[model samples]
Target: MSVNTFNHRWASVILEALTRHGVRHICIAPGSRSTPLTLAAAANAKFICHTHFDERGLGHLALGLAKGSGERVAVIVTSGTAAANLYPAVIESGLTGERLIMLTADRPQEMIDCGANQAITQPGLFASHVTQSLNLPRPTPAIEARWLVSAVDNAVALQLQGTVHINCPFAEPLYGEWDNEEQAWSEALGDWWQESQPWLQQPQSRFSESQRDWNQWSQKRGVVVCGRLSAAEGQQVAQWAAILGWPLIADAQSQTGQPLAYADLWLGNPKAQAILQRSELVIQFGSHLTSKRLLQWQNACRPQEYWLIEDRPGRLDPAQHRGRRIATAVGEWLRQHPALPGKPWAQLLTELSSAAHTCIEQRLANEFGEAQVASRMSALLPPHGQLFLGNSLVVRLVDAFAQLPIGYPVFANRGASGIDGLISTAAGVERATCKPTLILLGDLSALYDLNSLALLRQSSAPVVILVVNNNGGQIFSLLPTPIAERERFYCMPQQVDFSHAAAMFGLHYRQPQDWASLYQQVTQAWQHGGVTLVELKVAETAGAEALRQLVQQVGAL
Candidate 1:
C-alpha cells in the first residue's frame, strides 16, 4: 500500500477502536493537518461528527457532549497552536473527569527541530492536564497495524477519567488513494480484523472497599452533599438521603430535589452551622461542592468521620481534609448499602434555608435584575430542559440561591471554570440531550465567548442565551479590592450589547425590561423552537451586592 493509504488506514483503525469503546460523538475543527482523522470519522456511519472553526470551542463542545451523554467523546484538531488552544478544556477534563479523546495531527519527526513552521513540539503538549498521552509515529509498513489498535484500546480502555491525547505525526502526501491490501500482510491482526470488537478488553475500575462497618457509620448523624453528577445519579442519591433522613446539600449542577437548597446562603447563619457541625459523621456523596461556606465549616469542624464518596479516584477535597475517599459509581455504592433510617438530623437547617429562599423571592418579586433572573431559575425553567451556567456571577447566583427544577439536567464548565466556550458547550448539550437549553451568563462571559453564538444558530432544539448585561465582570465587585484598582483593572467594564450579535447570528433577540416580560420572552422562545438571546441589562454591582445582602439577612435567621 502507498504511504498515504497507510496513513488513512492508520487513522481509520484509531476511529474504529474509539467507536468500539463507546464513543459516538466526535468534534472536529476544520484544518488540513487533521484531515486524516476528520475523513476517517466522516467515512464511518457510527459517529455523529461535529465540525467547528475554533479548536477551543470544539474541545468544549466535546466536553459538553461527554458530560451529557456519560460517554467518551472524541476531538480532532490540527497541530501547532490549534492543539495548544485545547489546554483550558484539557485542564477541565483532568479536574472533572469528563472523558475526551483528543486526536491531534502533527508534522512528522523529520519536520521537527529543523526550524520547521507549524511544527512546535507536539509531544506532551497537554502534559499533566491529560490522563494519558500517545505520540504515534508516522504510519509505516515497518510498524505493525495491530500495535496501533492495541495502543488506542489500552489508552481509551473503560476509563472516563479525563482526556487521552493521541498525537498523530504524518509526513507529506497525506491525502491519497486508500486500500485494505496492507491488512493482508499483517498475520498479527488475529481475529480482530474480522470482528467488530476492540483489540483488547480492559479491566473494570472497582472500588477498593474498605467496607468498614457501615452499620457503625449509618447510626451517626450524617449529611449527604452532592456535586456535579448525572441526572440519574443525583435523583438516586437524593432518594438515598431522603430515606436515610439526612440533610442533603446539593449543587445546582446535580439538579436533584434539594431540601435545604438555599443552604449555600443560609449556611452563613451561626445557628445553622452549629446545628450541622454537631454531626458525628458527615458523609459527602460527591466532590467539587460549590458552597464555600459549607466546605469552610467542614475544614474548621473536622468531624470525627468525614467520608467522601466519588467515582473518580483523586484527592478531590478542596480543604484537603484527611477523609475516606471511596472510588465507585454512585449507583453501585447506593445499591451495596441499604438506607438505615434514624431520626432526621439538622432539621432546623431546613427552616433557616427556607427563610433564605423566601428572602430571595421577596427581593426579586416583580423585578428583573441579575439576582432576580437567577432566583427565578426554578420557575423559569421546565423539567424538559437543561442549564449551562457561566463561570462568573450567574453560576454563583444559582449555586447560592436557586433551587433547581428536579430531574432537569444541568451543565457547566465548573472545572477550570473559565468564562470561555460556554456557548459552544451549551449548544453541544442541546444536541446531545435533544432538549431545550438555557445558558445563563454574565455580560463579560458572553463577550468572552461571543463568537460561539454561531454554534447556537445550529441548535436542533430551543436555546436561550440569557446574558445578564451587568456591563463588566461584576463578580470582581464581590471581592474587597482597593477602590483605586477595582473598576479599571478588575471589573474592566465593557459598554456593549448582544442585540447586534444576535442579529449577526440570525437569532431571535429580546431585551426584557421587567421580570414578567423576561419570563414570557424566555418561555416563549423555547416554545417557538430556535435560538434566542435575552439580554438583561442591570447595574454593575447588583448581583454581587444583592447576594451579600441576602447572606447577611439569612445569617440573621
Candidate 2:
C-alpha cells in the first residue's frame, strides 16, 4: 500500500485513471522531468508503454496509434522543447478529431520564467489546438488525491472531442523511497484503487440533423462527395449515394469502393467537367479532398445548394460553398432521414468516369512510371489491409491511379498534410493493427521523416514502405514555376537513394526497374511479413509528364 514518493503517488493515480478510462497505449520520451510518469507507466501492467527518443516522432506515433486503434492514446514528455515538439501532432489531432492525451512534466511555478533549467511557461502551450489543457499543481500531501483522479477523468472525457493536455508540475526530489505514514495515504484511496473503473464517466453527445433540414434537399439533383472517411462511414456514404442515385465523388482517403472511379480525371477533363456540373446540389460527407481539380469544380459550379455532413465542428468548406453545415455523422443523418428511391441523376457523370478510368488504364499500362507504380501497389494491397499515404505527389498519384481493393482503409496525415511524420505515423498504424500495412511516399517525404525509419524495427506487423524516388519534389515540376528556378526553390533535388537507408534500418530493400518487378517485390514484401523498403526509381520529370499525358488523353476521350 506504500506507493512511496508524492510524485509517484500522483503519477500512479493519473495513470490509473487513464487506463481505467480505456487508454491502452502510453508513448514516453525519456527525460528527467518525466521520470515520475514514465516509472508509473512502467509499473502499470495494463498499459502498453512505447518508448521513443524523438519527441516529435513520439507525438505522431501516438497520433497514428489513436487513429489506427480508434482509441485515445497518451503521450508523456518533459518540459520545455520536449512539450513543444508535440505541437505538430497536436495540431493534426485537432484537425482530424483524433483523441490524444498529452501528459507533459514541467517545473513548478517558481522555476518557470525564472531562468530555471528545463523549465518554461508550459500552461496553455497548445492553447486552442487541444480540446482541454490543465496545469496540475506541484505534487504535495496537501492536494486531494481524488482531485487528481477527477482531473484525469475530465481530460479523458474531453479527449473524445480532440487531444487533451495535462501539464504536471513537480519540484525537486522527484523520486524517493516510501515511508510508513505514506502507507496510510495509499490505504485512504480504498475502493478507488481496487475498482478497475474510471473515477468519473462522461457521456459523449451525438449529433443528428433535423428532418426538416434533410427534407429540404432530399429531392434535388445532387452528388455525394466523400472525403477522408473511415471505411465503415464510406460504406454508408456509398449506400446513400446509390439509393439517392447521386454520383459519389470519393477521395482516395474516403475508403469508399463504389465511388465514381477516375472522378479526378473526369473533373480535369473539360468535357467531363461540363457533364459533372449538372448537379444542382452538392452533399459532401467529409473534408480535405486530395484533388485540387475537385475544389476548382466546386468553385466553378457554385451549386444552388451545398450541404456538408461531418461529425467534427470545423469549417471544412474552405471554398465557402456550403450553404448548410450539418454538424452530424453522415450515417446518423442518413438514418434520421431514410433515402427514398429516386431517378438516376448522375448516370452521365458515372459513364464519363468509367471512360476516364479506361483512359488511365491505357496510359499506365506497360509503363514503368510513378503512376504505374501507384496503380500496381493499389491493386496489390491485401484485403482489409491499411494504406498510409504520404503528402506531396504520392497521395495525389494514388488518388488518380490506384484502384483500391474493396474495404481497404486508407490513412493520411491530411489534416496538416505535412511530410514530417508520415513514416512514424505509418509505423504507429502497423503497431496498432498488426496487419499488412503499406506506406506510399515520395523521396522528399521519405527524407523528411527519415529518422522515423527507426520505428519500423518496433513494428510487429509487415510494413511495405514504397518510396517513389523521383530525386526530389517532382510535384513542383507539374506546377507553373519557371524552369530555371524549379530545381532551387521548388524541386529541391536530393540525389540520395534508399538502398543504404533500408540497410541502415535493417529492412529488406529492393529497387524495382519495371512494372512487373515492382509488383512482384511489393507482393513478396507484403506477404513475407516484415519491414521492407521498395524504392521505385523514376525520372525526376517523369511523374509530371505522365500526369500531363494522362490529362491530355482524358481530355481527348
Candidate 3:
C-alpha cells in the first residue's frame, strides 16, 4: 500500500482495527466534517451503526451500548459546538466510569483558526473527563493504519478502565473523490518525511510493595465494594470471594452478583453504614457510589486501611485513598492474600443476611397495605435477567424490598445518580444484548427520556419497563431536607400518561393499579414480544414510611 493508497483505505483500516478490537457499536450524530467517518463506518458490515439526530442522545446511546454489552463503544460527531453536545454524556460516563469512546472530526490547524464554520480546537477537549485523547495524523499507507491501531488499542485499554476521547483531525477538502483523498494524504505524508513512533507491547503491571501490604490489609475485615464488573470478571471475583471469605457488596451497576442474595448488609443500601462501621478495611473498585448515607459513613469512619484498585492511575478511593493507587488485578491481590484463620466476618454477615431476608418476607406478607406493591414487583422480575433500575425512589425501593438476585447482572447510574438518560441507556442495552431487559424506572425518569421511545423503535430486544409512578420524584420526600416552600423545585411531578406515550411508540402498555394486576401485567410483559411498559401507582407518603421502616430493619441486622 503506497502513501496515496493509505488515504483511500484509512477509514477501512480504522474500522478494521476497531472491529478486530471488539467494538460492537458505533453511534453517529450527523454533521458535515464527520461525513467521511460516518460513511466509512456505515460501509462496514461488522460494526452496528446507530444514528441519533441529537449529539447528546448519541453519547447516551453509546453509553447504553457499553453498559449493555459490557464492552467499549464509540460516539462520533463533527467538530465545534456539535462536539460540545457530548459533554453531558461524557461527564456522566466519566462519573459512572462507563467505557465510552468519543471520536470528534476536526479541521486541521490551518482551517481551525481561519473562522471555519464547524472548526474548533478539539484536541485535549475531553482530556479531563476521558482516559485518553488523540489527534490523528494525515492518512498515509505507512502511518495511517499504524495510528488507527494504536489509537484503538490505547482507547480500549482506557475504555476497559473507563471513558476515553479521541479526536480525528483531517486536512482540508474533507470530502472529495476517492482518488483526491488518496493524493492529498500522500502529499501530506511526503511533506512530513520524518519517521513515526513504533508501537510496543504494553508492559504487564504487577502489585507493588505497598500493594502487598494493601492486600494483607484488605483481608482484615475488608469489604469488596464493586461498582461494575464485566461478566467474566464478575464470576472470577465471586470465586475469589468464596475462597477468601470476603463479603461482596455491589450496586446495580456492578454487573456482578452479590454473594448473599438476600443479604441486607450489602454496601450502598441503607444497611451498609451499620456493616461498614464494624469494618477495619475497605477495598474500593470502579467509580463513585450513589448512596449519600454510605458515602458519609465511609467519610465518618475513615476505615483504618482503604485500598482502591484501578488499571489507570488516579484516585481509587472516593474517600481520597490517602494511599497510592495500586496497579494490580483485584483477583491477583485476593489470590496472594492468606485465607482467614477465623470466620467471624462470614458468620456475622450470614446472620445479618438471614435476618434481613426474614424481615423483607414478613414485611411483604404481614406488613401494612401499599408496601406489597413494591415487594411484589421486585419478586416478579426474572431472577437472572438484566435489570436496568431507574434512579430515585424506584432504585431505593428495589434496595429496600428486593434481595439482590443471584447471577443477575444489575445496572444503574450511581455516579451522578440522575434520571435524565435512563430510557436512552435502556434502549442501548435492549439493542446490544437482545436480552429481556427489565427497566425498573420512576415516573420522572420515564418522562426524562421520553425521546428514548423514539430510539426504542430501533431496538431488537423486548424491553419491559416497570415505571413506579408515585406522581413525582418520591425520593425527595425521603430526604432529610424537606422542601416545604421549594417542593416544586425538587418534586416536579407531571401528569404524563405512559399508556398514551407507549401507544405513540407502537409499544405495549399497561397500567396496573393493584398488586395482583401489577403481577399479572409484569408476567405478560416479561414473556410477551416487543417492548412493554407496566406502570404502577403507589402513594408517596405511605411508601416513604414503609421505606423508613425497612431501613430500620436493615439497621437491626
Candidate 4:
C-alpha cells in the first residue's frame, strides 16, 4: 500500500521496523490520535494485532505475551491517560526483566501545555521503570527517514535490558490521504523496504562467575531455594539440587515439579524448622518466593553464608543476606562447576514435609473448599498445560496446598503482585503458549479485570477459569482488622455470582457445588477447546479459617 501523508509514511516505517525487529504481536487500544499507527499495524501482515478497549488490560496482555513467549511484545495506545495506564505493566516488566515495547501516541509539541484535548506530558511518564524512553518529533521532510528507523532499531535493542518506551507525537491531519507523493518518499528506501532484516542488530552480552567462586560456594551445607524461574531453568536447578543433595525449596511459581512437597508447611513446624536451621549456607536461584513462612524461616536460620545466582540485573535479596550475588544464568553456573556428591542436608526436613503433606490430605479429603479446589486443580491440571495463578489468597492457597505437578508450567504476576490484570495476563499466556491454560482467580480479582474476559475469545487453546467466589476479598479476613468492621472495610463482599459474567463473555459457565462437579467441569473444559468459567462458591470466612486450622495442624506436627 502506498502512503501519501507524512503521518501515514511515518506510521508505515515504524510498524515495518517493529516487525523486522522480531516483534510478532502488538496489543492496541482504540483512540483517534493513534489511528494512523493502528491502521498501519492492521495492514502489516507480519504483525498480529490485538485490540482491547482498556489500555490497562492491553498493557498486561503484552506483558503476558512477553513473559510467556520469551520474546519482545509491543503495545500501542493513545495519549493522555491511555499512556499513563501502561505504567503498571511497564513497572512489572522492568522489575521482572521482561522485554516490552511501548509505543504511545501523543499530540504535537505545540499542543502540549496549551490545554489541548488528549494531550499531556508524554515523555518520561514511566519514570525509572522503563529501560529506555524516547520522544520522537512529528514526521517532517527535514528529518531523515533513516533516523526514525534507526531510533526504532536502538529502542528495540535496548528492550533486551527491559521495556522500551517510544512516545510518538503527530501533527494535525493524523489520518490523511494516501497518495503517490508519500509513496514516492517511501520508495526512496529502495531495497530497504523489501528486506526482512532489521535496520540495526545489536549483540546481546552475558555475565558469568569465576570457577573458583563456584568451587568454594558449592562445598557448604547449603539449601537450594528456587523462586520464580522458567520451566527449563527450574529443571536445570532441580538437577543441580539433586546432584548436590541439597533440599530444593521451590516457590509455587517456580514450576520445579521436584521441589520438596509441603516445604512451606514444614517450615512452619518447629520440628522441621530445627532441621532446616542446621544448614550453614543458602543458595537461592530466581526471585520472589510466595511463602511468607519460608521467608521467615530463611531469616530465622541466618545461615553463615547466603549466595544468590540470578542472571537478571537487580536486587533479588531484599534482606541483604546474600553474601555473594552471582550474575549469571543458573544453567551456565551449573555447567561451569563440577558436581560434588555430598551428604543429604535436608533429609529430615524432607521426611517432615511428607508428614505435613499427609496431614493436609487427610484434612481436605472429605471437606470440599477453596484449598481443596486448589489441591484438586493442581493434581488434575494436564501435564503439558500452563497454570496462571491469581495473587492474594488464591496464590497463597496454591502455595500451601497444591502439589507440584510434573511438566506443568506455572505463571503469575509476582512482580507487583496486584490482583489487577490477572485474566488479561492469562489470556496473553494462552496466546503465546497455545497450550491448555488454567487460571485460578478470586471473585474480586476476576471483577477487577472483567473486561479481559473478551480477550479470552481469541484464545487458540482451552482456557479454564476457576473463579473461587467467596463473596469478596477474603484475604482481608486474615488481617488484624476488628471482626465487626472487617466486612465493611476489608472484605467488601460482592454477593454476585460469575455465571452471568461467563454468559456475557460467551464462555461456558458452571457453578460447581461439590468436588465431583468441579473436577468434571475442569475435565470437560480441558477436553473441549474453548473458554470456560468454573465458579467454586464457598463461605467468605471459610477459606481464612481453613488456612488457620491447617497451619495449626501442621505446627502441631
Candidate 1: worst-modelled 10 consecutive residues by lDDT: 184-193
Off by over 4 Å in 4: 1-4, 182-190
Q: Model 3: residues >4 Å from true position, as ranges?
A: 1-17, 107-121, 136-160, 169-177, 180-226, 231-280, 284-287, 310-312, 321-325, 338-341, 345-353, 362-378, 553-557
lDDT of 4 by residue, 285-379 (tens): 89888887888876666888788888887668878884788878877887877668877776877777778778888988887889887666665
Evaluation by lDDT, superior candidate among 2 and 3: 2
Cα error, candidate 2, residue 499 (Å): 1.5
Instruction: Return the lDDT, model 2, position 256.
Output: 84
The local distance difference test score of model 1 is 0.83
Ranking by TM-score: 1, 4, 2, 3
lDDT of 1 by residue, 78-187 (tens): 98999999888888889888899999999988888998888889889888888888999888878877788889899888455999999998876778777766765454
Count clashes in each candidate, considering only residues at least 3 apart in sequence or on different chains.
0, 0, 2, 1
Write out the backbone clash pairs for model 1.
none
Candidate achieving higher TM-score, 1 or 2: 1
TM-score of candidate 3 relative to the true fold: 0.81
Clashing residue pairs, backbone N/CA/C < 3 A, model 3: 228-254, 252-410
* Residue pairs that clash (backbone atoms under 3 angstroms), model 4: 4-179
